[model samples]
Target: MRDSKLIYYRSGCHSANFTTWLIMDVIVQDVNPAISDLPCYWNRETSKSVGLQSTRKLSCLWNGVDVYLPFNFIKNYFEIFGAFSLNHGVKEFDVSHSNSRVLTPSSRYNPREEFMHFASFDVEGRSRVLCVSAGEGVPLSTQWNPQGYFYPTQIAQFALAHYSVHSQAQHRENIKRYTIQLEQEDTAARVRDEDTNSLVIQFKNTLEFALSSPHLVLSLDLKINSDIKTWFKVQLLAEEEGELFTLLYTQSGIYIQSDGSEFQFGFGNKASGRWLRLTRDLFTDLKKGLTHSNDKKKAKKLKRTKLKVISLKFYGSGNVANISLSDGEDLRMFLDGANWFLENQDENGGWPSNVIFNQGQKKYPKAAEIQPGWYGAMCQGQAISVLSRAYHVTRDQKYLTAAEAALGPFQKPVAEGGVKTVFLDRYDWYEEYPTNPSTFILNGFMYSLIGLYDLQNISPDNVIVQLLFKRGMRSLLALLPFYDAGSATFYDLRHFTMQTAPKIARWDYHTTHINQLLLLATIQNSTVLSETAERWRGYMVGKRAPHN
Candidate 1:
C-alpha cells in the first residue's frame, strides 16, 4: 500500500488502489450525486451560506512522501499530484542565442483559424486555456489554471490563433480613432450621455457617421427600446450598392445583411432596454455573409475592398455608445500566450499539462491511457511554431532560445518522459498524448511537424532540427495509408489499443485532418498525400471509394 500510487474518488477519503512506481498519483474523481451530509469543497467565504465554515482539505502519506490535497482542488474529472521534474529523467540543455538565425517566412504552412480555435484566458500575466463546461452564461472556465497549471494543446492553439492574425499586413499605419459626429442637434439625431452613460448616441428618425477610412473590427454598446416593424439599419459603404453591408435590427432579431446575402444572430429580446456590448470582426463577418454569392466578379471585388461603416439609418428609437475601431487585437492576445510559453516552460524544456486527459478510456486500454502531468508533441510543436513566428516579427533572441530548448523532449522516448515513440518498430510517431501504446493522432502529429518545419526554416543550418523534420516527414508519408479507413479516416492509430474498434474521425476532425494533409503537401510534394487529401475531402459529400 505504501509503495503504490494512491487514488481518491474526491467525495471523501475513500481510496482506490493502483500499482505503479511512477511519481504521479492519479485522483479519479467521477461525477456522482451530491450528498447533503458530506463536506463541500467550496471556498469558505463564498460557500458559508450553506452552513459550511471551511472548505474540504485532505492529507495522506503515499510512498513515504506526505501528500496534501489543496482546497477546492477538484476542478475537473481527473487530477494529478506530483513533481513535474520527476517524470522527465533527461538532463536540461545549455540554451544559447549566439547560434540563433533569422526566421524566414514560408507560405507553405500557415496557422488555420478553423483548427486553432481555443480561447485564451489571461490570469495575471499568464495565459490559461478555457474549456467548455455545463454552466450557463459562463460556459467556459479556466479549469485549474489558478494553481499554476495549463493545457499545452490549448495554449498552442491559442498561440496559432495569434500567429494567423499577426502574419497579416496591418490595415493602416496608425490606429483609427472613431467619434460620434452628429449631422444635427435635433431629437432625431442627438449624442448625449444618459443615466448609465453606456448608451450615449440616441436617434429616432435617422443618423449617420462617416469614416475617414475602412477598418477591420468594430466595437460598440447597443440598446434596443422596442421591437419595431421597420428596420433600424446600420449600413457600411452605403454609396456602393454592390459592397453594401448592413446590420438590421427588427422585430425578429439582429441580422447581418451583406453583399446581397443575410444571416441572423441569436434569437431573443437580448438587447431590449438592456445595454449589450459587442465586438465583431467586420471583415470575417462580411466574408461569411458572402459565402453564397453567385457573382464571381462582385465577390472578388467585395473580398478585395476594405469595408467602411459610413451611415446609421434608424426607423425606430434606440441608443448606441462607445464606438471604436481597430486593425485587430489578436496580436496582443497572441503575444500574451507566447510570452506565457517562454516563462512557464519547465527545466526539461517542455510545457507540462497539469490537467489529466481521460478521453482515451473509450478507445484505449488502461495501460495505453494518458497519464497526468503529461507533455504532448502537438503542444511542443504548436509552441515552437508560435515562438518561431514571434522571433520572425520581433527578432527577439529569447523566443529563439526558448524554441531551441523546447526540442529537448523530442530527443527522449515516451518511456523516459518524452513524446517520441516508434510505431510498429519502424516509423517515428510524435504522440499527442504519449501513452504506453502511442496514439498517433493525425492532426496532432501534423501540427508537431509544422512546428519542426518552422523551426528548421529559421535555423536551416541546424542539423538537429533538419533531421527531426526530415524524419517526421518520412514517417508521415509512410504512415498515411494506415490512417485511411476506405470510406473515412481514423483519428488515431488506436486499433493497437487491445484491438478496439477503429475510432473514425468526426466531421470536424476529418476536415481538419484533410486540411492538415493539404498543408503538408505544400511542404513535401507527395502524390499519396495530395490524393489522400482530395479523396478524404470527397467523403464529406458522402462519396465512397471502390473496395477490392
Candidate 2:
C-alpha cells in the first residue's frame, strides 16, 4: 500500500498532497470508573474525509477501546463528547507515537477552555509533552478549530520543544564523553615522555591550572660536564583558537619576537640546583608580553588572549634530567622552607640580614654572627608581612608573637635603632636606619606601611600600630609634589627641609612609587589619595603602557 500523509480536513475540504504518511497507534482509556460507562467511537466519516479510508479494528482495554489512527485523523476524534462526561471533560488521553507513549491534557489544560496536548516517545524511551491553548473561552463541544491560524503555531512550538530537548541532551552527553576522553589522555600524557635530549615538562590537564598558578617551582638534578657558562632556554607553547604561538623565556626576560620586535621584562632569578621559584609576577610579565604591540588599539584587543601551556621545554648546554615542576599549592615543597624559617628565628623574635645553616655542622652558625640592625627596613617589613601571613594561615601564636615583636623597631625613636624621625622643617619620615642619616626612600617606607597593614588584620585594636600606619601614609602623601605629573616621573630624592632636589628621575622608581600610592589609597580609603593614585596611574599608563 502506498503511504498516506496526515492532512487536516476542515468542514469537507481535504489537503491535496497524500504522498508522505505518519502512522500512529492510539489507545484511549478512562481512569475514572464513573466515566468509563460513556461511549466513544472513531468518527468514520471524518476520518474518510481526510483520506483515512480503512476502518481500524478496535480492541477491548481496561476502560476503553484501542484503535489505530492515521496521524492526520487523531485531531478529528479530539472532541468525541461521549468518551467522558462533558462536565468532567476528557481530562487526559495517551497517544502512542513511534516507540514511546505520550499522555496529554497536561497541567496547562483549563476546565473552562479548550487546548491541544501533544506528546511523543522515541525508540530510546525519551518522552516529550507539549500543551498549547486552543483559545480563551472556547466551547469544548466545538471540536478544536483545526483551521485556526494558531493551530499550526501550536504544532510548530511542540515540534521545536521536542527537538531542542533532544538536541540539548545529545550535546551534553557528547561534552561529558569528550571530557572523560581528554582526562584519560591527560593522565596518559603525564606518564609518557617525548623522545628528546633536553628535559621537558608538560601539564596533562587543561593549561588553565598551570597558567593561573601564582608561582611555579622547577626542581631538577642537573649534571654539567665542564665549567661552562650556560643558561636554560624556556619556551611556552600556547594555543589560541586553532592557531599556535610560542613565548620564550631567557635570563634576560620573557618575550615573543616573531618579527624581530621583542619586548622583554626581567623577573628575578635564583640559583640552578635548588628550587627556582617563579612568582605571580612572572605571569604578569607573560600577560604583558602577549599584549605588547606597536598599535595601542591592537594591544588592547589582545587583552583577553588565553594561552594554554601545551608544553614547557628547557634547553640547556649540559644534560638536564630528573625534572619536576610544582605550583604554589604544592604544600609538600612549601613546608620545608617554612620549617627552616621557624627553626632559625632569633631569640629576640627577629631574623638577621642572612642566616646560613651548615648541613655538616648541623647548626646555624651564621645566625650568631649576623645583626638585625644591618638588615634594611624593607627587608624587615617583608619578613614581618611573611610571618603575619604564616600565622594567619596556620593560626600559630608563635608567628603572631614574632610579627608583633618585629614592629618594635619601627615604633622606637630614631635615637634608639628605629624608624621614628622628626627631620628638618618637620618633614617626618620612617628612617631606614637611625645611625645612617640619609634621604628617605619611598619604597622602603611603603613596604613598612604594607607590613603594618597586614599585621593590623590580627591586632586591629593596637593604637600604636594604627598611629604609625597613618603617619607613614600621610608622610608619603606629603611628598607627592616631588613627582612630575606631566612626565609621570619621580625625582630620586626629596631631602628634609626641601633643600636640594635632583634633576635625575628613574622610570622604575616611578612605577614602584605609583604602586605604593595605590596600595595606601586603597587601605586608607582617602578620596584625595585615591585621586592622586588615579592620576599617577593614568599618567603612567600613557607613558610606559604597564599591564593592569
Q: Looking at model 2, report the run of 10 residues with the lowest lDDT sum.
A: 133-142
Candidate 2's residue-wise lDDT over 1-548, tens digit each? 21222222212113653222223323333234422222223445557778876544332112233223333344444321112123356443333211211122223321111112211311111111111111110001101222121121122223222322333344335321101112233322332223444332333222221232212333343322233333442233333444333444334422122222233322213223323333121232343344444333433443223433344443443333344433321222222223334554555444443222122322222212223234345545655555564565468787677767776667666556555665444655665433333446666667677767767766788776688777777776676665544645544344432244443334455555665665565557667656665665555433333455
Which regions of candidate 1 deviate over 4 angstroms? 1-107, 110-149, 170-327, 359-363
Name the lDDT value of residue 395 in candidate 2: 81
Query: CA lDDT, every prediction?
Result: 0.59, 0.40
Q: In candidate 1, what are the lDDT values of residues 441-476, reduced to their tens digit?
A: 888898899889888888777788888888899999
Q: Best candidate, lDDT-wise?
A: 1
Q: What TM-score does structure 1 among the candidates reach? A: 0.50
Off by over 4 Å in 2: 1-350, 354-373, 425-428, 433-435, 483-486, 491-505, 541-548
